[model samples]
Target chain A: MADELLEVTDLTMRFGGLRAVDALSFVARRGEITAVIGPNGAGKTTVFNCITGFYRPTGGGVLLTHADGARFALQRLPGHRIARRARVARTFQNIRLFAGMTVLENLLVAQHNTLMAATGFGILAVLGLSRYPVAERQAIERAREWLDAIGLTERADDPAGALPYGAQRRLEIARAMCIDPVLLCLDEPAAGLNPRESDELNRLLLRIRADGCSILLIEHDMGVVMRISDHIIVLDHGRKISDGTPEQVRADPHVIAAYLGEGDEDEVPAEEVVA
Target chain B: MKSALRDAVLSALVALRPVPVAIAVAAVFVGRLLLLAWRGRSRAAARHANRAFAERLTQAGKYVAPLLLIVALAVPLSGDRYYLHLGILVMTYVMLGWGLNIVVGLAGLLDLGYVAFYAVGAYSYAIISTTYGLGFWTCLPIAGILAAIWGIMLGFPVLRLRGDYLAIVTLAFGEIIRIVITNWVSLTNGPNGISGIPRPTLFGLKFTPAGGPGSFSDFFHLPPSPTWRAVYLYYVILVLALLTNWVTLRLRRLPLGRAWEALREDEVACRSLGINVTVTKLTAFAIGALFGGFAGAFFATRQAFVSPESFTFIESAIVLSIVVLGGLGSQLGVALAALVMIGGFEVFRALADYRMLVFGAALVLIMVLRPRGLVAGRTPTVALGRKREISAELVAQGRG
Candidate 1:
C-alpha cells in the first residue's frame, strides 16, 4: 500500500445502456511499468480515459498518491488540473502533437505552467521585468535534452507533424515526459511501429521507468507488453480478468480466453494466440 | 488545360461585360501561363520554387516595414486633406484587423460580433465625455475598459461553442448590440444618434483659429489652419495603431501567445498539456476588444458623432475579411490588406455604379489565386536553433 502510486477502486463508466468500464479496480505501484492489455473492445482505453480524467467515471475513485504522500482524487479535478495539479500526463491512442508547432515548442508547451508562473502570467514578460528569460533558457535547455534523448535533436526546429511515424511516437513520449509527471499514461504507444522502432521504444520506455517515474500503459503489442511490463492487468468485458506479474498473467486461463475466444484454448498456447 | 483556360476566360468575359474586354483577356492569359508553368514542374522543383518564393518574401519584408513607415510619416507633409483622411481610415482598419487576429487568427475563435465592442467604446466616449465634460485623453482608457468588460460578458456564453456555431452566436451578438443602441432611448438616443462630440486637444490646447490662452495656435505662435487639426489627428491614430501592432508582436513571443496558437492547433491537446482553455479564450477576447475600443474612441473624436448606423454587421464583416485576406496571424499582411481594401475602395470611386461589382470581382480573383491570403507563411515564436519560417502548407488555419 505504501508503494502504490495509483489506486483505482470500483471504477465504473456507463454510456446509457453500455458499460465501458464496469467496477474495474487496479493498483499501479510506484516506479514500475504496469501494462493494461486486452482484446479489441475489452475496455482497456476506457480504464485509461477514466484515470486520466478524460471521462468521469459514473461511479468510482481514482486516487493518486504523490511521493511525499500528497493525495489527489483525480476524478474530482478538472481535465487540465489533472495534469497540472495531479502531475498525470497522457498521450492519445491516435497521436495528438501540436503538429503545426516546432518540436521544441511542443515540449515547451508541456512546461507551460512553470514558465507562466515565472513570467507572472505574461505581464512581467511583456514589460521585460520578470525572470522569464532565464526560465525560458532553462526550459529550452530541458527541451533540447529530451530532443537528444529521442534522437530528434537535428529536427528540433521542424514541425512535429513532419517527423516520421516512429519518430513522432517517440516525440509524443518525450513531450509527455517534459511535464515531469509523477505518472505517465500512454494509450497504445506501440500501435504502428516497425520491429526496429518497437525495439527502440522498449529502450526509451525502460529509460523512463528507470528514471523513477511510474508508467500506466495500454498496449496491444504483446511483445512490448510482455517484455517491459513489470506488472500486468488483464481486462475482459470491462472487468479485470487477471492481475499479476507478466508470467502469471500470461499463464492465466481467462486472459487467453479473452484474446483467443472461448472453448478452443487447449489447442494453441496463450503465447501464440495473444501475441 | 486549354479547355480549362477557355472556360475561365469565358466566365471572366461574362462577369465583366461592363468593363474593358482586353484587360480581362490579358489577365486570364497570364494566369493560364503561370498555371501551365507550375503544372509542368516536378514535385521537387515545385517545392524548390515554394522555398525560393518564401525566402524572397522574407527578404522583401525586412525592407518593406521601414519603407512603409517612412511613407506613413510623410503623408502629413503632403498637405492633402483627402489623403490624410484616407490614411486615418486605413490605419483604423489595420488596428481592428490586428485586434481580431488575436481571436480568429491566433486563438482561432471566430468573433463576428467584434463591432459590438467598437460600438461600446464609441458610445462610452460619446456619452461620458458629453455628459461629464471630460477630454478625449481622459475618456479613452475608460472606453477601452468598458469595452473589455463587455467582451468578458460576451466571452462567457460562447466559450462552449466553436466554428460555425461560434460565428452565429457572435453574429447575433453584433446585431443585439446594434438593436440595443437603436431602442435604448434614454441612454443611446434610440437611433437619433449622438453628435457634437469634442475633438482631441494637444495637452488641453484646442486646435482653434482664434489665438487665446488655451489654443494650439496661441501656444505655438503659428498661423492657425484647419489642415493642422487633420494632420494632428492623423498622427494620433498612427501612434495608436503602431502601439497595437507593437504590443501584439511582443505578446506573440510570450507564453500567453504560444498558448493561443496551441489552442488554435488543437484545443484538446492544450488541455492535456495543463492549459486553462477558459482563461486563454477570455483573455484573447478581452484583449482584442480593448484595441477595438481604442479605435472606436478615436473614430468618435475624429467624426465628432456616434451613431448605430456606423457600427453595423457590415463593419464586422469588413474587419473579418481584412484579417482573412491579410493571411490571419501575419501583422504585416493585415496592414497591407487594410491599405488595399480601404484605399482601393476609394480608387474605384470613378466607376460610381460599378464600384461594388469591381471590388467583388477582385476579392473573388484574389481568393482563387491565393487561397491562403497574401502572406501565407508563419514565423515560429521560439526556436532551439536557427528560426525557420513555416511554409503555408504546414500552418494550421484555426477552425475559424
Candidate 2:
C-alpha cells in the first residue's frame, strides 16, 4: 500500500546452524505503532538488527519508503547510512547512550548531521562565519524541546550516565527523537521501567504516533503492546505465528499456542496467555 | 607534629644526596597511606579525598596559570641563556603535549606514534630550508601540511583498529618512521642527520650579527649578542604553542570537536547518531598531527639541525606520558604536566646519575596519589543555565 512505510519481505538471518529469523515478512504502516512481540529468543531483535543495517540479512530485502516516495534498500546500506540517509533511528535493548556526555549534549549529538551540515563540516563553525550560530541555537532549541518532553530539562547539564535508570531510558528515546526520524525502532524500552514509567512510555509512544512518526516496538510487556499498539505481529521460533490488529492477534489460536505451548495450554490461566 | 618534625629532620639530613631525597618522598607517601589505612577509611572514601585534593589543585592552577605565563614572558629579561634554553625545551614539549592531547585526550585515540609526525615536520623543515634554501617561515606551514598528509595516510589504514591494536600499529608506525630516517641517506642524510638548518627570521631580518644590512640587532640599533637569537626563538615557540591552545579551545566548542568527544564516548552510539565516524576520527588524527608538525618545525629551526635520534620512540612515550600525567583532554593539565615532567628533569640535572631513578619514583608516587592524573574533573563544552563540573567517574576513557 502507499501508506506502508517499511516492508520486510522473506527476511532470513542465520547464524551457523541456528536460524535466528527465518523468512519473516511484515509491513509497518505510516503513523502507526506496530508491536512485534514474542517470547524470549523469538528473533524480534534480530529482525530489528537486520532492518537497521546492524546485520546483513542472509536473504531477502528490507525496503523503506520515504514520505516523498523515495525508496531505500536498508540491508545494502552501512549501519550509519541507514540512520543518516533513510532516517531510521533505533534505541538499543541495552541502552547505548553517550554516557559520558551531558543529557543535553547527548541530544545534540543526535542532531550531528544537521549541525555538521550547518557548520559546513566544522570549517565555518570554527571561523564563526555563515549560519552556524543560528543553526546551533536552533539545534539547542530542538534539544531543549525534547528534554522538556521527556522531563529531563532540569538534569540537562548532568552526565547521561549519572541519571536514574528510568530517566536514562526516557533520555534515550528523546535522543532518538532528536534525529527527526521517520521510523523509530525501540528495542525493549520498557524492560526495567517501573509500572508508572511504563505508563509514561505508552503515552510517549502515542504522542510520537500522534506527531505522524511510525514506531516499530519490540516489547515483552503485554500491557504496553495491547494498549498502545495499533497492529501486532507475533513471532515463534523465528517464524510469524500471527499478524493483525491487537484484538485479532489476541484472538488467534496460533498466538495463544505460541505463548502457552501446545500441551500445557490448560496448565496456564487464560488471562495470562500472553503475559 | 612530632612525627612531621622527625620526618623533616631526616629529609634535611639526607638533602645532600638525590637518592635519599627520593627515598624521603617515597617514605612520606607510604606513611600517609599507612595513616589513612589505620584510620579505617574505605577505598571509596580515600578516592573521594583524592578527588577533593585534585579539585583544589585545579583551583590553584587557575590562579597560577597567569602567573606562570608572566614568568614565561619575562624569562629573557634575566639574560640567563641556560634558563632561556630550558624554557624553550619545556614549551616545545608543552606544544607537543597539547597536540597529542587532541588524539589521546579528546578523541580517546591512544596514539603511540605521535612523534612520527613530529619527525616528519622536523625533517620537512630541515630538508626544505637546507636543500632548497627556503626560509623557515616558508617551510613552517609546508612542514605542517606535509605532516598532516602523513597523518591522513596513517589514519586510512588504521580506521578499523582500536585500543591495543591501534596502539601497536601507531607504535610500529613511529618505529617505521625513525628507521626510514635512519636508512634513507639520500633524502634525510640517514643517522648523519641534516645540519646547518636555517634559523627563522623576523620578516627577512636575520638574528645574526653578520647580516650587516638586514639584521635584528642592526635594524633595532642594539648591541649584537647571541642571546637575542635565543630570545627570538623562545617567543616563536611561545606564540606557536599559544596558537595551538587557542585552536584547540575553539575547536572544543565546535561541531567537529563535539563529534570527536562523542566518538570517544561511544563509537557505536556515534554511528547510530548518523555521524560519519571515519571522517571524525581522521580529522582528529590530522589536526593532532598538524600541531605536532608545527612544533617539529619549531624544533628544527631552534636547533638549526635535524636528526633521527631526536624522534625516537621514547620521545613519543614522553609526550604521551605528559598527556596522561596532565589528565586526558584537560589542556591546562597537559601544560602543567609538560612543565613538571620536562622542567622537573632540568631542575634535577644536578643528580645526573640518579635522575631516571628519581623520575621513575616520582611518577609512581603521582600515579598512586592521583590515579586520574592531576586534573580529573571535566567541564562541559556547552552548558544550559549554570555549568556544572562532570566528575572523572562519569567520563568514558575512550578506549579507541
Candidate 3:
C-alpha cells in the first residue's frame, strides 16, 4: 500500500436505484501495471471515471500518492483539472479526440492548461515582458518529443477523425502522454485493435511502464491482463469478486466462474497468455 | 469651405498617401513567413511544405487589408457618386462584420439580434442629438455604453443555454428590442422616425453656409453637394474600422478569447478546465454589441435621420452571414466576406429587390459547402506550436 500510486477505498456509485459500482476498492502500485478486467457493464469504466476525475462517485474516496511524495484526492478535481493540473491523463472508451482538430493539435491541446498558465497574463507576454515564451517553448518541445516517441511525426497535420481506428487509439495515448501524467489511466486501449495493433499496444504499455509511470488499465481481454499486468482486479455486477496476481486471479473460483462457465472452471488446461 | 477638408481627406485616403504604412504591415508578415521557411529548410520536407503554406497565407492576409483600404479610399476619390455610396455602405457592413466576429467568431456565441444593438446605437444618438441638441461625438460612447448595458441584460437570461438554444434566445432578444423601439412612438416617433437630425460638424464648421465665409458650395467653388459630407463619414468609419480590428485582435489572444474558443469547442470541457464560461460569453456579447452601437451612432450622425425600419431581422441575418461566409473564427475572413457581401450588394444596386434573395441563398450554399465554415476550425496552430506531421505510412495504415 505504501508503494501504491493510487488507492481506492470502498468506491460506490448509485445511479438512481442501480448500483453501477458497489464499494469496490483496490490499489495501483507505482511503476507497475495494474489491470482491471470484467465482463461488459461490470463497472470497469465507472472505476476509471472515478479515479480520473470524470464522474463523481456517490461514496468513497480516491487517494493518489505520487513517487515525489505529493498526495492528491482525485475526486475533488474536475476532469479538466485532473488532466491538466494533477497530471493525470486518460484515453476514452469511445475515443474523445477533438476530431475537428489536426492530429498534432490534439496533442498540443492536452497541454492547453500549461500554455494558458504561461499566457494568461496575456498582453504582458505579447509585449515581450513576460515568461510566457519560455513556458511556450517548453510545451512545444514536450509535444514534439511525445509525437516522436509515438512515431506519429508523419501524420501531424492530418485530422484526428480521419485516422483509422487503431492509429486514433494510439494518438489518444500520445495526447495523454503530452499531458505528462504521473499515472496513465487507459479505458480499454485494446478495444478495437487488430492482433498486430494489440501487440503494438502491449509493447507501448511495456515502454510506458519502463518510464517509471504507473498504469491502471481496464480491459476485457484476459490474455492482455495475464501477459502484462503485475496486479489484476476482477469485478462482477459492480462488486469486486477477486484481486491478485494474474495466476492467483485465474485460480480464484469466483473469477473462473465469471469468465468461463462456473462448473467448467476445472476443465481448463494450461495455456500461455498471448498479447 | 468646411466640405473642402472632407473631400481632401477622402482623396488622400483614396490615393493611399502613406503607402509605407501598408508596406510596413506587409513586411511584418513577410518576415515571419521567411523566418518560418528558413527554419524548416533543413528540417523535414513536410515541414518546408507546411511552412510555405503558412507563408502564403500570411502574405495573402497582409495584402488583403491594405488593398481593401486602398480600394475603400480610391473608389470614392474618383468622384463617382455611385462608388462613393457603395464604399460607404461597405464600411458600415465592415464595421458590423468586425463586431459580429467578436460575438460569433471569437466567442462562438451566435447572436441574432446584433442589429438590435445597431438600432439601439442609432436611436440613442438620434434622441440625444435632436432633443438635447448634443453633438454626435459625445453620443458615440453613450450609444456604445447603452448597447453594452443592453448586451449584459440579454446575456444574463441566455447565459446558461448552449448551441441552438442560446442562439434562439438571443435572436428573440434582438426582436424584442426592435419591437419596443417601433412601438414607443411619443418619444421615438415610432415608424415615422426622427428627421431633421443634425449632421455632425467638422470642428465649428457645419456643412451649411452659416459659420462659414460663404455658402459651402460658393466657398469651395463647387455645387452644393452632400458628397462632401459623405466622404467625411466614410473616412471616419474607415478609421473606426481599423480601430475595431486592432481591439478585436488584441482581445482574441487574451484569456477571455481562449475561454471563448474553449467554450465553443466543448462547454463541459471548458467548465471542467476552470474557465468561467458565463463571464466569457457575456464579454463577447457586450464587446460585440458595443461595436454595433458605435456603428449605429455613426450612421445616425451621417444620415441625420433614424427609423425603426433600418434595424430588422434581415439586417441581423446579413451580419451573421458575413461572419459565417468569411470563416467561423477568422477575423480577416469576416472582413473580406463583409466587403464582398455588402459591397456586392451595392454593386447590384439596380437589382436591390433581389439582392437579399441572392444573399440568403448564398448563406445556405456556404453552409452546405463547408459545414464548419470557409476556414472551419482552422486556428493559427502556431498558438499551440510546431507539431510533427504524423507519417503518411501510418495514415495508409489508418485507412486499413
State the TM-score of candidate 2 restricted to chain B. Answer: 0.90
Candidate 1 structure quality by residue, lDDT tens digits, B69-165? 8999999999999999999999999999998888878888888888999999999999999999999999999999999998999999999987777
* TM per prediction: 0.92, 0.93, 0.73
* Alpha-carbon lDDT of model 2: 0.87
What lDDT does each candidate get? 0.86, 0.87, 0.72
Off by over 4 Å in 2: A264-275, B1-45, B209-211
Native contact fraction, candidates in order: 0.69, 0.74, 0.13
Give interface RMSD, per candidate. 1.0, 1.0, 6.7
Classify candidate 1 by CAPRI docking class. medium
TM-score of chain A of 1: 0.95
DockQ of each: 0.73, 0.73, 0.12
Off by over 4 Å in 3: A1-4, A64-77, A120-131, A206-212, A261-275, B1-66, B106-108, B116-160, B179-228, B243-290, B303-309, B330-333, B351-380, B383-400
| Model 3 C-alpha lDDT per residue in residues A1-275, reported as the tens digit of each score | 33978889999999999999999889888889999998888999989888877699999999988677888888887666676656777777877665645676566566666766776455575455667668767866786777677677777777676788988898888877776788888899999888888888888899988987778899877767789999999999899999999999988877876877444344664441210
Question: Which model, 1 or 3, shows the larger DockQ?
Answer: 1
lDDT of 1: 0.86
lDDT of 1 at B366: 63
